[model samples]
Target: MKKEWVFGTVIGISLVLGACGAASTSDDYDPNEAGAEDIEPDMAGFVMDQDENRILVVTPMDEETAKEGRAMWVSEAPEGLWIGKQVEVWVDGAIAESFPEQATAERVQELEMSEVEGADLKASEALSTALSEADRENILAVELLAFDQQADQWTVKLKERGDSQGEWKTIVKDEK
Candidate 1:
Protein backbone atom coordinates (compact mmCIF):
# COMPACT_ATOMS: atom_id res chain seq x y z
CA MET A 1 0.00 0.00 0.00
CA LYS A 2 2.85 2.41 0.75
CA LYS A 3 4.58 1.76 -2.60
CA GLU A 4 1.33 2.19 -4.52
CA TRP A 5 0.61 5.53 -2.82
CA VAL A 6 4.13 6.84 -3.61
CA PHE A 7 3.80 5.83 -7.28
CA GLY A 8 0.49 7.65 -7.66
CA THR A 9 1.90 10.81 -6.12
CA VAL A 10 4.86 10.77 -8.51
CA ILE A 11 2.59 10.32 -11.48
CA GLY A 12 0.37 13.23 -10.46
CA ILE A 13 3.31 15.60 -10.02
CA SER A 14 4.79 14.58 -13.38
CA LEU A 15 1.51 15.25 -15.18
CA VAL A 16 1.26 18.71 -13.64
CA LEU A 17 4.78 19.61 -14.69
CA GLY A 18 4.22 18.31 -18.21
CA ALA A 19 1.11 20.41 -18.64
CA CYS A 20 2.93 23.54 -17.56
CA GLY A 21 5.75 22.85 -20.03
CA ALA A 22 3.30 22.56 -22.92
CA ALA A 23 1.64 25.86 -22.10
CA SER A 24 4.95 27.65 -21.88
CA THR A 25 6.00 26.39 -25.30
CA SER A 26 3.01 27.98 -26.96
CA ASP A 27 3.40 31.27 -25.10
CA ASP A 28 7.00 31.57 -26.29
CA TYR A 29 6.23 30.77 -29.90
CA ASP A 30 7.55 33.28 -32.46
CA PRO A 31 5.19 34.43 -35.21
CA ASN A 32 7.91 35.60 -37.62
CA GLU A 33 9.34 32.16 -38.33
CA ALA A 34 9.18 30.75 -41.86
CA GLY A 35 6.55 28.10 -41.13
CA ALA A 36 4.37 30.46 -39.07
CA GLU A 37 0.92 31.15 -40.60
CA ASP A 38 1.34 34.95 -40.37
CA ILE A 39 0.21 36.70 -43.56
CA GLU A 40 2.56 38.98 -45.44
CA PRO A 41 0.78 42.04 -46.90
CA ASP A 42 3.16 42.45 -49.86
CA MET A 43 0.26 42.95 -52.25
CA ALA A 44 -1.81 46.08 -52.77
CA GLY A 45 -5.58 46.55 -52.21
CA PHE A 46 -8.22 49.10 -51.24
CA VAL A 47 -9.56 50.55 -48.06
CA MET A 48 -12.73 48.71 -47.12
CA ASP A 49 -13.71 50.85 -44.13
CA GLN A 50 -11.98 53.71 -42.38
CA ASP A 51 -14.02 53.69 -39.21
CA GLU A 52 -13.23 50.04 -38.59
CA ASN A 53 -9.62 50.44 -39.75
CA ARG A 54 -9.91 47.67 -42.30
CA ILE A 55 -8.31 47.17 -45.72
CA LEU A 56 -9.34 44.82 -48.53
CA VAL A 57 -6.20 43.15 -49.85
CA VAL A 58 -5.17 40.06 -51.78
CA THR A 59 -2.03 37.97 -51.41
CA PRO A 60 -0.56 37.77 -54.88
CA MET A 61 1.53 34.88 -56.01
CA ASP A 62 4.59 35.71 -58.10
CA GLU A 63 2.93 34.25 -61.16
CA GLU A 64 -0.77 34.13 -60.23
CA THR A 65 -0.78 37.55 -58.48
CA ALA A 66 -4.34 37.53 -57.23
CA LYS A 67 -5.73 35.91 -54.08
CA GLU A 68 -8.84 38.11 -54.01
CA GLY A 69 -11.53 38.88 -51.42
CA ARG A 70 -9.50 39.29 -48.23
CA ALA A 71 -9.83 42.03 -45.64
CA MET A 72 -8.02 42.74 -42.37
CA TRP A 73 -8.12 45.24 -39.49
CA VAL A 74 -5.45 47.93 -39.28
CA SER A 75 -3.71 48.90 -36.06
CA GLU A 76 -3.38 52.59 -37.05
CA ALA A 77 -4.76 54.83 -39.77
CA PRO A 78 -2.43 56.69 -42.12
CA GLU A 79 -3.00 60.43 -41.86
CA GLY A 80 -4.98 62.45 -44.41
CA LEU A 81 -6.52 59.26 -45.81
CA TRP A 82 -10.06 57.99 -46.01
CA ILE A 83 -11.95 54.91 -47.08
CA GLY A 84 -12.63 53.98 -50.75
CA LYS A 85 -9.03 54.57 -51.82
CA GLN A 86 -6.15 52.23 -52.62
CA VAL A 87 -3.91 51.37 -49.67
CA GLU A 88 -1.29 48.90 -48.49
CA VAL A 89 -0.79 47.49 -44.99
CA TRP A 90 1.65 45.58 -42.86
CA VAL A 91 -0.06 42.97 -40.70
CA ASP A 92 1.40 41.52 -37.53
CA GLY A 93 -0.44 38.18 -37.38
CA ALA A 94 -3.84 36.62 -37.12
CA ILE A 95 -6.10 38.04 -34.42
CA ALA A 96 -6.45 34.49 -33.08
CA GLU A 97 -4.75 31.26 -33.99
CA SER A 98 -7.94 29.78 -35.49
CA PHE A 99 -9.58 29.01 -38.79
CA PRO A 100 -10.80 31.80 -41.12
CA GLU A 101 -8.02 34.02 -39.85
CA GLN A 102 -8.34 37.78 -39.30
CA ALA A 103 -5.24 40.02 -39.54
CA THR A 104 -4.19 43.09 -37.56
CA ALA A 105 -2.27 45.75 -39.44
CA GLU A 106 0.95 47.18 -38.01
CA ARG A 107 1.17 49.94 -40.63
CA VAL A 108 -1.12 51.34 -43.33
CA GLN A 109 -0.13 53.18 -46.54
CA GLU A 110 -2.26 54.96 -49.09
CA LEU A 111 -1.64 54.67 -52.82
CA GLU A 112 -2.37 56.88 -55.85
CA MET A 113 -4.35 55.24 -58.68
CA SER A 114 -5.50 57.79 -61.17
CA GLU A 115 -3.17 60.33 -62.78
CA VAL A 116 -4.26 63.54 -64.47
CA GLU A 117 -2.21 66.47 -65.70
CA GLY A 118 -3.21 68.71 -62.81
CA ALA A 119 -1.83 70.12 -59.55
CA ASP A 120 -3.27 67.18 -57.61
CA LEU A 121 -1.69 64.57 -59.90
CA LYS A 122 1.80 66.00 -60.17
CA ALA A 123 4.42 64.31 -57.97
CA SER A 124 5.10 67.48 -56.03
CA GLU A 125 1.39 68.20 -55.75
CA ALA A 126 0.50 64.58 -55.15
CA LEU A 127 3.14 64.26 -52.45
CA SER A 128 1.66 67.15 -50.51
CA THR A 129 -1.84 65.82 -51.02
CA ALA A 130 -0.87 62.31 -50.01
CA LEU A 131 1.09 63.08 -46.83
CA SER A 132 0.89 65.68 -44.10
CA GLU A 133 3.40 68.54 -44.02
CA ALA A 134 5.52 66.76 -41.40
CA ASP A 135 5.59 63.49 -43.34
CA ARG A 136 6.59 65.18 -46.60
CA GLU A 137 9.59 66.88 -44.99
CA ASN A 138 11.02 63.57 -43.76
CA ILE A 139 10.65 61.68 -47.05
CA LEU A 140 13.66 61.30 -49.30
CA ALA A 141 12.32 59.28 -52.20
CA VAL A 142 9.20 57.50 -53.43
CA GLU A 143 9.06 54.29 -55.41
CA LEU A 144 6.04 52.85 -57.21
CA LEU A 145 5.52 49.34 -55.93
CA ALA A 146 2.59 48.04 -57.94
CA PHE A 147 -0.77 48.93 -59.43
CA ASP A 148 -3.85 47.70 -57.63
CA GLN A 149 -6.99 47.89 -59.78
CA GLN A 150 -9.52 46.99 -57.12
CA ALA A 151 -8.33 49.98 -55.12
CA ASP A 152 -8.07 51.88 -58.40
CA GLN A 153 -4.72 53.36 -57.33
CA TRP A 154 -0.99 52.98 -57.79
CA THR A 155 0.80 51.62 -54.75
CA VAL A 156 3.90 53.58 -53.78
CA LYS A 157 6.57 53.01 -51.12
CA LEU A 158 8.45 56.01 -49.70
CA LYS A 159 11.68 56.18 -47.80
CA GLU A 160 13.18 58.91 -45.63
CA ARG A 161 16.89 58.35 -45.34
CA GLY A 162 17.55 59.30 -41.73
CA ASP A 163 20.48 61.62 -42.37
CA SER A 164 20.95 61.83 -46.14
CA GLN A 165 23.20 58.80 -45.58
CA GLY A 166 22.87 55.16 -44.42
CA GLU A 167 19.85 54.63 -42.20
CA TRP A 168 16.43 55.26 -43.73
CA LYS A 169 12.80 55.16 -42.63
CA THR A 170 10.13 54.04 -45.06
CA ILE A 171 6.79 55.83 -45.37
CA VAL A 172 3.76 54.91 -47.51
CA LYS A 173 1.87 57.55 -49.49
CA ASP A 174 -1.25 57.63 -51.67
CA GLU A 175 -2.72 60.08 -54.19
CA LYS A 176 -6.39 60.99 -53.84
Candidate 2:
Protein backbone atom coordinates (compact mmCIF):
# COMPACT_ATOMS: atom_id res chain seq x y z
CA MET A 1 0.00 0.00 0.00
CA LYS A 2 2.90 2.42 0.65
CA LYS A 3 4.42 1.74 -2.76
CA GLU A 4 1.11 2.38 -4.58
CA TRP A 5 0.55 5.63 -2.71
CA VAL A 6 4.05 6.96 -3.60
CA PHE A 7 3.61 6.04 -7.28
CA GLY A 8 0.20 7.74 -7.40
CA THR A 9 1.62 10.95 -5.85
CA VAL A 10 4.48 11.03 -8.35
CA ILE A 11 2.07 10.61 -11.27
CA GLY A 12 -0.10 13.46 -10.04
CA ILE A 13 2.88 15.81 -9.71
CA SER A 14 4.12 14.86 -13.15
CA LEU A 15 0.71 15.59 -14.69
CA VAL A 16 0.53 18.97 -13.01
CA LEU A 17 4.01 19.93 -14.21
CA GLY A 18 3.24 18.80 -17.74
CA ALA A 19 0.04 20.88 -17.84
CA CYS A 20 1.88 23.99 -16.66
CA GLY A 21 4.61 23.60 -19.27
CA ALA A 22 2.02 23.24 -22.04
CA ALA A 23 0.14 26.29 -20.87
CA SER A 24 3.27 28.42 -20.84
CA THR A 25 4.24 27.41 -24.37
CA SER A 26 0.75 28.11 -25.65
CA ASP A 27 0.66 31.52 -24.00
CA ASP A 28 3.83 32.52 -25.81
CA TYR A 29 2.35 31.69 -29.21
CA ASP A 30 1.13 34.64 -31.32
CA PRO A 31 -1.53 34.46 -34.00
CA ASN A 32 -0.09 37.56 -35.78
CA GLU A 33 -3.51 39.08 -36.32
CA ALA A 34 -3.59 42.52 -37.88
CA GLY A 35 -4.09 45.29 -35.30
CA ALA A 36 -3.82 49.07 -35.26
CA GLU A 37 -0.19 48.83 -34.24
CA ASP A 38 0.48 46.34 -37.01
CA ILE A 39 -0.71 48.70 -39.74
CA GLU A 40 1.97 50.06 -42.10
CA PRO A 41 2.05 53.17 -44.23
CA ASP A 42 1.24 52.70 -47.89
CA MET A 43 3.83 55.22 -49.04
CA ALA A 44 6.80 57.11 -47.68
CA GLY A 45 8.87 59.87 -49.26
CA PHE A 46 10.03 63.47 -49.18
CA VAL A 47 7.67 66.33 -49.75
CA MET A 48 8.45 68.02 -53.05
CA ASP A 49 5.77 70.68 -52.79
CA GLN A 50 2.69 71.57 -50.80
CA ASP A 51 -0.45 73.63 -51.04
CA GLU A 52 -3.16 74.35 -48.56
CA ASN A 53 -4.96 71.11 -49.34
CA ARG A 54 -2.40 68.81 -50.91
CA ILE A 55 1.23 67.90 -51.01
CA LEU A 56 3.39 66.22 -53.59
CA VAL A 57 5.67 63.43 -52.44
CA VAL A 58 8.47 61.86 -54.40
CA THR A 59 10.42 58.71 -53.60
CA PRO A 60 13.85 58.35 -55.11
CA MET A 61 14.46 55.33 -57.24
CA ASP A 62 18.06 55.16 -56.08
CA GLU A 63 20.53 57.29 -54.25
CA GLU A 64 21.36 58.99 -57.54
CA THR A 65 18.10 59.27 -59.38
CA ALA A 66 14.47 60.24 -58.74
CA LYS A 67 13.41 60.38 -62.38
CA GLU A 68 11.89 56.95 -62.24
CA GLY A 69 10.83 57.25 -58.62
CA ARG A 70 7.17 57.10 -57.71
CA ALA A 71 5.36 60.40 -57.17
CA MET A 72 2.09 60.81 -55.35
CA TRP A 73 -0.27 63.62 -54.51
CA VAL A 74 -1.58 63.40 -50.98
CA SER A 75 -4.87 65.21 -50.53
CA GLU A 76 -5.82 66.78 -47.22
CA ALA A 77 -2.24 67.20 -46.21
CA PRO A 78 -1.61 67.75 -42.56
CA GLU A 79 -0.69 71.15 -41.25
CA GLY A 80 2.93 72.02 -40.38
CA LEU A 81 4.15 70.12 -43.47
CA TRP A 82 6.66 71.96 -45.57
CA ILE A 83 8.72 71.29 -48.66
CA GLY A 84 11.54 68.76 -48.30
CA LYS A 85 10.14 67.21 -45.15
CA GLN A 86 10.20 63.44 -45.02
CA VAL A 87 6.89 61.78 -44.23
CA GLU A 88 5.05 58.48 -44.12
CA VAL A 89 1.51 58.49 -45.45
CA TRP A 90 -1.29 55.99 -45.11
CA VAL A 91 -3.80 56.17 -47.97
CA ASP A 92 -7.48 55.92 -47.36
CA GLY A 93 -8.15 53.71 -50.38
CA ALA A 94 -6.78 52.73 -53.78
CA ILE A 95 -4.42 55.17 -55.49
CA ALA A 96 -5.35 56.61 -58.87
CA GLU A 97 -2.92 55.54 -61.61
CA SER A 98 -1.51 58.72 -63.09
CA PHE A 99 1.57 60.83 -63.27
CA PRO A 100 2.00 62.08 -59.75
CA GLU A 101 -0.67 59.69 -58.63
CA GLN A 102 -3.44 60.98 -56.38
CA ALA A 103 -4.64 59.55 -53.09
CA THR A 104 -6.38 60.69 -49.94
CA ALA A 105 -4.21 60.68 -46.89
CA GLU A 106 -5.78 58.77 -44.06
CA ARG A 107 -2.87 59.53 -41.81
CA VAL A 108 0.37 61.41 -42.19
CA GLN A 109 3.35 61.39 -39.89
CA GLU A 110 6.61 63.26 -40.17
CA LEU A 111 9.71 61.12 -40.19
CA GLU A 112 12.60 62.19 -38.04
CA MET A 113 15.51 63.67 -39.92
CA SER A 114 18.66 61.63 -39.60
CA GLU A 115 21.29 64.37 -39.18
CA VAL A 116 19.85 67.86 -39.12
CA GLU A 117 20.97 69.01 -35.72
CA GLY A 118 21.91 72.69 -35.49
CA ALA A 119 21.70 72.94 -39.28
CA ASP A 120 21.05 76.36 -40.71
CA LEU A 121 20.13 75.18 -44.19
CA LYS A 122 16.75 73.62 -44.77
CA ALA A 123 15.96 70.94 -47.34
CA SER A 124 13.90 73.37 -49.37
CA GLU A 125 16.78 75.79 -49.56
CA ALA A 126 19.11 73.07 -50.75
CA LEU A 127 16.61 72.01 -53.39
CA SER A 128 16.15 75.54 -54.63
CA THR A 129 19.88 76.02 -54.99
CA ALA A 130 20.21 72.81 -56.92
CA LEU A 131 17.35 73.73 -59.21
CA SER A 132 18.82 77.11 -59.98
CA GLU A 133 22.23 75.59 -60.63
CA ALA A 134 20.71 73.05 -62.98
CA ASP A 135 18.91 75.80 -64.93
CA ARG A 136 15.62 74.79 -63.36
CA GLU A 137 15.25 72.03 -65.93
CA ASN A 138 16.51 68.49 -66.44
CA ILE A 139 17.05 68.07 -62.74
CA LEU A 140 16.24 64.54 -61.65
CA ALA A 141 16.83 64.77 -57.96
CA VAL A 142 18.32 66.80 -55.14
CA GLU A 143 19.67 64.97 -52.11
CA LEU A 144 21.08 66.46 -48.91
CA LEU A 145 24.49 64.99 -48.17
CA ALA A 146 25.47 66.78 -44.98
CA PHE A 147 25.15 69.91 -42.93
CA ASP A 148 28.06 71.64 -41.19
CA GLN A 149 26.69 73.95 -38.56
CA GLN A 150 30.07 75.40 -37.66
CA ALA A 151 30.72 76.34 -41.28
CA ASP A 152 27.07 77.08 -42.02
CA GLN A 153 27.25 75.05 -45.21
CA TRP A 154 25.04 72.39 -46.69
CA THR A 155 26.35 69.70 -49.05
CA VAL A 156 23.74 68.82 -51.64
CA LYS A 157 23.94 66.26 -54.42
CA LEU A 158 22.22 66.90 -57.71
CA LYS A 159 21.27 64.37 -60.34
CA GLU A 160 20.74 65.98 -63.71
CA ARG A 161 18.45 64.60 -66.34
CA GLY A 162 20.08 61.86 -68.44
CA ASP A 163 23.17 61.91 -66.23
CA SER A 164 24.37 58.66 -64.75
CA GLN A 165 26.52 60.43 -62.18
CA GLY A 166 25.40 62.90 -59.53
CA GLU A 167 27.41 65.97 -58.57
CA TRP A 168 27.82 67.14 -55.02
CA LYS A 169 27.63 70.88 -54.37
CA THR A 170 28.30 72.86 -51.23
CA ILE A 171 25.80 75.61 -50.43
CA VAL A 172 26.48 78.27 -47.87
CA LYS A 173 23.56 78.91 -45.57
CA ASP A 174 21.66 82.05 -46.38
CA GLU A 175 21.45 84.53 -43.52
CA LYS A 176 17.86 85.43 -44.32
Candidate 3:
Protein backbone atom coordinates (compact mmCIF):
# COMPACT_ATOMS: atom_id res chain seq x y z
CA MET A 1 0.00 0.00 0.00
CA LYS A 2 2.84 2.42 0.87
CA LYS A 3 4.63 1.49 -2.32
CA GLU A 4 1.46 2.12 -4.36
CA TRP A 5 1.05 5.57 -2.79
CA VAL A 6 4.65 6.47 -3.58
CA PHE A 7 4.33 5.18 -7.12
CA GLY A 8 1.08 7.10 -7.65
CA THR A 9 2.71 10.31 -6.39
CA VAL A 10 5.64 9.81 -8.76
CA ILE A 11 3.35 9.20 -11.71
CA GLY A 12 1.24 12.21 -10.94
CA ILE A 13 4.34 14.40 -10.66
CA SER A 14 5.66 13.09 -13.94
CA LEU A 15 2.36 13.76 -15.72
CA VAL A 16 2.27 17.31 -14.33
CA LEU A 17 5.85 17.87 -15.37
CA GLY A 18 5.13 16.46 -18.82
CA ALA A 19 2.14 18.72 -19.23
CA CYS A 20 4.16 21.76 -18.22
CA GLY A 21 6.91 20.82 -20.64
CA ALA A 22 4.43 20.26 -23.44
CA ALA A 23 2.97 23.74 -23.01
CA SER A 24 4.92 26.37 -24.96
CA THR A 25 6.50 29.13 -22.90
CA SER A 26 8.21 32.24 -24.15
CA ASP A 27 10.46 34.15 -21.79
CA ASP A 28 9.47 37.23 -23.81
CA TYR A 29 5.75 36.51 -23.65
CA ASP A 30 4.00 39.86 -23.40
CA PRO A 31 0.77 40.41 -21.55
CA ASN A 32 0.39 43.61 -23.56
CA GLU A 33 0.44 41.94 -26.95
CA ALA A 34 -3.36 41.66 -26.88
CA GLY A 35 -3.66 45.47 -26.82
CA ALA A 36 -3.01 45.73 -30.54
CA GLU A 37 -6.14 43.72 -31.41
CA ASP A 38 -8.56 45.77 -29.26
CA ILE A 39 -8.61 49.43 -30.17
CA GLU A 40 -8.62 50.67 -33.76
CA PRO A 41 -8.35 54.46 -33.73
CA ASP A 42 -7.53 56.86 -36.52
CA MET A 43 -4.45 57.99 -34.60
CA ALA A 44 -2.97 56.70 -31.38
CA GLY A 45 -5.67 55.40 -28.97
CA PHE A 46 -6.82 55.20 -25.36
CA VAL A 47 -5.27 53.42 -22.38
CA MET A 48 -6.23 52.20 -18.95
CA ASP A 49 -4.09 54.00 -16.36
CA GLN A 50 -3.25 52.94 -12.86
CA ASP A 51 -0.84 55.36 -11.20
CA GLU A 52 2.41 55.69 -13.19
CA ASN A 53 1.66 52.55 -15.13
CA ARG A 54 -0.72 52.72 -18.09
CA ILE A 55 -1.59 49.93 -20.48
CA LEU A 56 -3.76 49.41 -23.53
CA VAL A 57 -6.57 47.11 -22.51
CA VAL A 58 -9.32 45.80 -24.78
CA THR A 59 -13.01 46.69 -24.43
CA PRO A 60 -15.88 44.20 -24.43
CA MET A 61 -18.31 46.07 -26.69
CA ASP A 62 -18.83 44.91 -30.29
CA GLU A 63 -20.44 47.91 -32.03
CA GLU A 64 -19.45 51.58 -31.64
CA THR A 65 -21.51 54.69 -32.37
CA ALA A 66 -20.88 58.41 -32.63
CA LYS A 67 -22.93 59.17 -29.55
CA GLU A 68 -21.83 56.10 -27.60
CA GLY A 69 -18.42 54.48 -27.36
CA ARG A 70 -15.97 52.80 -24.95
CA ALA A 71 -13.56 54.23 -22.39
CA MET A 72 -10.39 52.93 -20.74
CA TRP A 73 -10.07 54.96 -17.54
CA VAL A 74 -12.62 53.96 -14.93
CA SER A 75 -13.90 56.51 -12.42
CA GLU A 76 -15.92 55.92 -9.30
CA ALA A 77 -18.84 57.91 -10.68
CA PRO A 78 -19.80 58.65 -14.25
CA GLU A 79 -17.44 61.37 -15.53
CA GLY A 80 -20.48 63.14 -16.91
CA LEU A 81 -21.26 63.66 -20.59
CA TRP A 82 -17.84 64.07 -22.25
CA ILE A 83 -17.81 66.52 -25.12
CA GLY A 84 -15.69 68.93 -27.12
CA LYS A 85 -12.22 69.44 -25.69
CA GLN A 86 -8.75 69.85 -27.12
CA VAL A 87 -6.90 66.65 -26.35
CA GLU A 88 -3.48 65.24 -27.19
CA VAL A 89 -4.15 61.78 -28.61
CA TRP A 90 -1.61 59.06 -29.39
CA VAL A 91 -1.92 55.54 -30.85
CA ASP A 92 1.00 53.12 -30.24
CA GLY A 93 1.46 53.86 -26.55
CA ALA A 94 3.71 56.93 -26.75
CA ILE A 95 5.04 58.71 -23.67
CA ALA A 96 5.74 62.33 -22.79
CA GLU A 97 8.58 63.78 -24.87
CA SER A 98 9.81 66.51 -27.22
CA PHE A 99 10.64 66.47 -30.91
CA PRO A 100 7.90 68.22 -32.80
CA GLU A 101 6.90 69.31 -29.30
CA GLN A 102 5.21 67.87 -26.23
CA ALA A 103 1.40 68.09 -26.32
CA THR A 104 0.85 70.26 -23.28
CA ALA A 105 -2.58 70.43 -21.64
CA GLU A 106 -4.24 72.03 -24.61
CA ARG A 107 -7.97 72.77 -24.28
CA VAL A 108 -9.79 71.37 -27.29
CA GLN A 109 -12.79 73.62 -26.67
CA GLU A 110 -13.97 72.93 -30.18
CA LEU A 111 -13.78 69.52 -31.80
CA GLU A 112 -13.94 69.70 -35.58
CA MET A 113 -17.15 67.79 -34.76
CA SER A 114 -17.68 64.51 -36.42
CA GLU A 115 -20.43 61.93 -36.28
CA VAL A 116 -18.82 61.84 -32.79
CA GLU A 117 -21.20 63.46 -30.38
CA GLY A 118 -20.38 66.96 -29.16
CA ALA A 119 -21.27 67.84 -25.58
CA ASP A 120 -20.82 70.78 -23.27
CA LEU A 121 -18.38 68.94 -21.01
CA LYS A 122 -14.75 69.88 -21.42
CA ALA A 123 -12.12 67.16 -21.78
CA SER A 124 -10.26 68.39 -18.74
CA GLU A 125 -13.49 68.62 -16.82
CA ALA A 126 -14.79 65.19 -17.87
CA LEU A 127 -11.51 63.27 -17.55
CA SER A 128 -9.63 62.44 -14.39
CA THR A 129 -7.14 64.99 -13.09
CA ALA A 130 -3.56 64.90 -14.42
CA LEU A 131 -3.91 62.67 -17.49
CA SER A 132 -1.01 61.84 -19.80
CA GLU A 133 -1.06 63.19 -23.35
CA ALA A 134 -1.22 59.60 -24.54
CA ASP A 135 -4.52 59.07 -22.75
CA ARG A 136 -6.07 62.26 -24.05
CA GLU A 137 -5.08 61.61 -27.66
CA ASN A 138 -6.05 58.00 -27.46
CA ILE A 139 -9.62 58.98 -26.54
CA LEU A 140 -12.02 59.05 -29.49
CA ALA A 141 -14.76 61.15 -27.84
CA VAL A 142 -17.49 61.14 -25.22
CA GLU A 143 -20.92 59.68 -25.91
CA LEU A 144 -24.03 61.83 -25.92
CA LEU A 145 -26.58 59.00 -25.84
CA ALA A 146 -27.74 56.77 -22.97
CA PHE A 147 -24.43 56.12 -21.23
CA ASP A 148 -25.46 57.07 -17.70
CA GLN A 149 -26.36 53.45 -16.91
CA GLN A 150 -23.19 51.88 -18.37
CA ALA A 151 -20.70 50.56 -15.87
CA ASP A 152 -17.37 52.34 -16.30
CA GLN A 153 -15.42 50.35 -18.94
CA TRP A 154 -14.11 50.40 -22.49
CA THR A 155 -15.46 48.62 -25.56
CA VAL A 156 -14.12 47.72 -29.01
CA LYS A 157 -16.23 48.09 -32.16
CA LEU A 158 -16.55 45.97 -35.26
CA LYS A 159 -15.40 49.26 -36.76
CA GLU A 160 -13.30 52.02 -35.16
CA ARG A 161 -14.77 55.38 -34.18
CA GLY A 162 -14.78 56.99 -37.58
CA ASP A 163 -14.17 60.74 -37.79
CA SER A 164 -12.76 63.53 -39.94
CA GLN A 165 -10.31 65.83 -38.14
CA GLY A 166 -13.06 67.21 -35.90
CA GLU A 167 -14.94 67.74 -39.10
CA TRP A 168 -18.43 66.24 -39.57
CA LYS A 169 -17.33 63.69 -42.07
CA THR A 170 -19.98 61.53 -43.74
CA ILE A 171 -20.33 58.02 -42.40
CA VAL A 172 -22.31 55.31 -44.24
CA LYS A 173 -25.11 56.85 -46.28
CA ASP A 174 -28.16 54.74 -47.07
CA GLU A 175 -27.82 53.21 -50.47
CA LYS A 176 -30.99 53.94 -52.42
Judged by whole-model lDDT over C-alpha atoms, candidate 1 comes out at 0.46
Q: Estimate, for each residue in 1-176, the C-alpha lDDT of model 2 and write its tens digit.
A: 99999999999999999988883335444334454234577888766666787977777447554345667889987777456667888888889998668999988878776546776556555554544455433324455456767877776664433445455455656343
Clashing residue pairs in candidate 1, if any? 110-174, 112-154, 113-153, 113-154
Alpha-carbon TM-score of each model against the true structure: 0.32, 0.58, 0.21
Please say which candidate is ahead in lDDT: 1 or 3.
1
Tens digits of per-residue lDDT for model 3 on 58-125?
Answer: 23233353342334332221133332222223333332332222222211112232332333332223
Instruction: Give the CA lDDT, 0 to 100, for residue 18 in model 1.
Output: 92
Q: Model 3 clash tally? A: 10
lDDT, residue 123, model 1: 41
Q: Once all C-alphas are superposed, what RMSD does model 3 give against the true structure?
A: 16.3
- Total backbone collisions, model 1: 4
The local distance difference test score of each candidate is 0.46, 0.66, 0.32
Where in model 2 is the C-alpha error above 4 Å?
Answer: 1-35, 64-67, 115-118, 121-140, 148-151, 158-176
By lDDT, the best candidate is: 2
In lDDT terms, how accurate is model 3?
A: 0.32
